[model samples]
Target: MLAIPVLAAVITIAWAADADIYLESIDKKFFNSLNKIESIFKTWFPKFSFSTEYHIENYQINSLNNESYGLLYSGGLDSLSSYIKHKKETLSLISIWGADIPLNKTKFWDKVKYKVTQLAEMDDIKCYFIKTNVREMMNENLLNKTYLEGEDTNWWLSVSHGLILTSLTSLLPIKTLIMPSSMDENEKVPHGSDLFKFMDYRWADSSLIYDCNLSRHEKIKYLLRGNTQYYQFLRVCYTQFQDYNCGMCEKCLRTITGLLIEGIDPNKCNFKVKNGFLDLIKYYLSNNIILLHSEIAAWEDIQNNIPEESSIEFSFGLKNLILMIIIIKRTIKKEYF
Candidate 1:
């Protein structure tokens, strides 16, 4: 396993004062901290260098500025499509991986690593691979009741990445942190919403951090626009490894369903399960009741009209009863597995 030297202590001590102060008081200190991080990166990855011509801009932590664009790249289909779509305006790509997990253990880490390396080779953009001690960070912050809730692991993780990027921005001449989250991801019950909201809320609450922005719908539209080749490389499943996606997972089911709705065949991807199509149908039937209600509510709000019979409501009521019976049976048998 490759590891960067312990620069965390140096960063903590050097930026103690800046970290203590609210976002407003730490411009110079933040810049200094960023310089240190960049220096460490230069030592660790000598081939990588910051762009000489770029210029840095300062702002209140909550303010959105052009210089604030950095992508929380995950090497997934959504992120990859968004990145390719906005390649021209993007300043940098940032990825965070838990040091304990190893790339092979994580579902999409290898794919992401490969794509980022490819993108870095293009010379049009800069990619930063941030290794995080996630367990350590969680442990250190766990005493705080907010962190204990674990309401949004994704957002919390992103904020952790954001902090690193913000520190990097402090050193580099870039503004605007561009994250490619989606509207679907933001919707209730969707994957990683807790984490996304956590990062957004924390950044917004901070008096020191400024100009954080997320491009959800815009990125979606960009991907929807003729990016067929780019779409082929997207990986969304949380299971399976090395050229195959476990289609039964929540992510795989949703991706395939959406593609089908858009008239695309889910089986054509580089990764997929043998029974992906049937799995998607079965999952939809099992989960559709609640999902339909949520979708209907959203659609109703947009249309400003009621459905003739509220199919979602009827379906949910029926499905809830069935699910409850299943849970009861499992509890009775002590066969939770």
Candidate 2:
């Protein structure tokens, strides 16, 4: 059996749940960094009490190679853009099955794995496949009702995933680890994956690197510059039922709208939209079918990117789509606020 990130992974869940951990041995750097992480998170989320107690017998850490870097590749715009930016460097691509795609969804994961492997191979970068039940390890329903009830979210978003996902790569002998940003650095939305200012979340000497200075709109701009071949593998669907982008879902529609605003075709970006695709997107936006709290900023970014001079006049054009999105955003403010 391979060495797992047992101690590091458990501590992440423990932080949010305020549980006591009894681990015999763990990475020394991880132990040190997590202490700082607790302070950082507490400052960001002052409402919750994260008073986790640790009981460790010994410390076991790994040596570092300063130049080696590993990336958490999800085949999404952010990861793909990150890969494109760092293609010239020595990098390893890591993908986990249980996160985003369910462990039982082997068919979907196999396809994602194969596509990610091809991308790695093309760039002469090494690839690692991880399978873990991290997401399933804790009782979300119980946590949501108790420790996380006031949060209005489960363990995944408000806490757990940032360290949990990064911890899974603890066994990958690299000094620097990279995970793409879901929200921009400026966005005030509180999420588990938001960058920790006090810590890089070191585990076995490896440190997590989060560069969220660029917004989602800015990353999609990278795709427009002849990064075409990789576009076929883009997966931003809201469901694992689809192999690629489901243009109907809010996520897919958001990306579609972003690309459309940037003069990129959705069909070329692995999205197959029907006749009423724009209308469907409008319906989702108007009815609040998707989680709007953390999502509104991205939509606002897309809306702001729509050129004021655009007069395409088509349903999918900036003229109509921006108008619809603006109206829906106003409605969201009235309802959500």
Candidate 3:
């Protein structure tokens, strides 16, 4: 007679265990600061919450005598920069499922992961692949958009991914998890800001944001000094359905531009520059001012490195200007029509 109730209780307990991750006591001052930061984030989207099963109390924090390092690697430029610069100390390369890469798109994940795994192996680092249903669970079983969706839907993964990655450090003996900063110190707070990493450092297992002093452009310059072959596996394209960069997407163009300005051909890498990619590059520069402006800054920095007369057309011509005007007109018409 009591079997049904007993079974239900067992299932409930298992579900909670799976959903929540208990952590050591967090500092009271740090805990209060974390709450304030979270409150500010909540202002952007009131419906979204960063709260999870992160335990904080007055208990003493423990530390191992031997220090180990891990990094949150996504095979993207920022993470790749962090991984490569700190390759000597990085014992673990952690990649999460359904963060930016979609779980349903196994083809993309498989191909990217295979290449990244090979890169990790070359450096003798243990690559850890973690699969989670976090994204699907947050999608709310709807064909519609979630709270995190905005101008660029993929910027933030709805949850505090920094927190998620730090929480996992509890399972390991890692003393520090190096997280790559995506934006410059001067730029406005984007979706996944360094603030989250700072909070994770205080609350979750010890983690530090790597080289926030430099911008994306500066990182590419640092990468230029390293073996280009090491970064050939860098995968920045998210819109394309393939393993290789389509070379026309915003991310691809932005990254390829960085390489081009440095006198490196995108084709030599995993990026397959689309037909008339130069025209598309000009289009993005003229239209997407904010993103392209940063790329231009990178270009200016490497102007001396560029050959006097290179095949790559890093210029804005009259033809590109006309196309930009036409695109704007069409966009306006569509909006009003």
Candidate 4:
């Protein structure tokens, strides 16, 4: 259990640096799955592709202790949708401060704690808080300085988050671990979370399931359709600038656009949408200042939700934003994917 997560925390770094992985003992299932997952990533992200040998002293076989569903919850829409989708079987909800809030951000974790506590208490679910510095297990500055070639590159987004977050659940006994899909199945971007499916169905006796059947916008629509009050606890922001969804980041803006497309005021969903915020998005896109790596596919999901004939706020801003994302991808960021 200890060695598996530690290996996950560093495996991508090893792959990127072409360094070999040496482990004392690893679950044979996970080791085998890593090879397949690595191959898939090589096809998805060829720029960082590198092969490495795995030296394991012992390959142990493990089995599930019980039948229970667990989810990697972040109080975000994706996890919220996953929770609602499997709420009947989901007995355990796992949230790690290290993954997003960071170990030292006690204040931020308090906001997360309040929301998750309220959510679990309302749903009669078990919530576990794993506080660690696992996300800080690597020197990200050094990783980027060595690897980033003057473009946007996030260590957590493109490489280390999915496996490391899922592996932390090993500390608890779970039958199946559910990781929220960050993109639609049709999206072709190379994301670290996209590899979760290859790691599915086996890890010792526990299974890792990443569901991509529903797009992000579709998840929002599902949440609305379920008519559950649990959606009130959504926390979609990863930045340190706010208590919840900072409605200006590219992620928050995209999510805000999705919510607006569904006719819900973002303020009702843990985000503060100030006046003229839609114009701000237009300004950034018009000036070619993309707020983040711009998950073009996610933006495309929002685009698809808007009808071609409807000339609403989301329809117009999303139109130009998608164009900018496409232009950036084709001209500037094509080589990375």
Off by over 4 Å in 1: 1-69, 99-111, 120-124, 140-173, 184-222, 239-244, 267-269, 273-276, 287-337
Candidate 1 local lDDT, 1-337, one digit each (tens): 0011222222322232222222222243334434544444333222222332213334333332334356656666556765775677755777666532344455556665776667666546777776655435443353223222333223233223434433332322345555454444224322312233333322222112222132322332336435564555566654555554566655565455444333344555544534335534454445543243333333222222212323232211223323322332333234211
Q: List, residue by residue over 1-337, the lDDT tens digit for candidate 4.
A: 6677787788888888888977789888888877776777677555564768877889999875868888888888888888888888856889888877877778888888888989899989899888778766788887767754444556776667777888778868788888887555554335667776554535787887886678889988865544548658888888663468878777887787677666565777887777567576666455555534446656656666664443334322334434433443343334323
Best by lDDT: 4
Please, what is the whole-model Cα lDDT of each candidate in the order they appear? Answer: 0.42, 0.70, 0.55, 0.72
Q: Pairing residues by index, what is the TM-score of model 4?
A: 0.82
* Clashing residue pairs in candidate 3 (N, C-alpha, C atoms within 3 angstroms): none
Once superposed on the true structure, which residue ranges of model 3 sit more than 4 Å away at CA?
A: 1-33, 39-66, 140-159, 196-200, 203-205, 286-337
Error of 1 at 199 (Å): 12
Give TM-scores for every candidate, taking all chains together and pairing residue i with residue i: 0.50, 0.85, 0.67, 0.82
Residue 307 CA displacement from its true place in model 1, Å: 16
Instruction: Name the candidate, 1 or 3, with the larger lDDT value.
Output: 3
Check candidate 4 and list the clashing pairs. none
Question: Lowest-lDDT window of 10 residues in candidate 3?
Answer: 1-10
Task: Work out how many backbone clashes candidate 4 has.
Answer: 0
Q: Candidate 2: where are CA atoms >4 Å away?
A: 1-4, 16-18, 44-51, 149-152, 183-189, 223-225, 311-337
Q: Provide the lowest-lDDT 10-residue window in model 1.
A: 1-10
Better of 2 and 3 by lDDT: 2
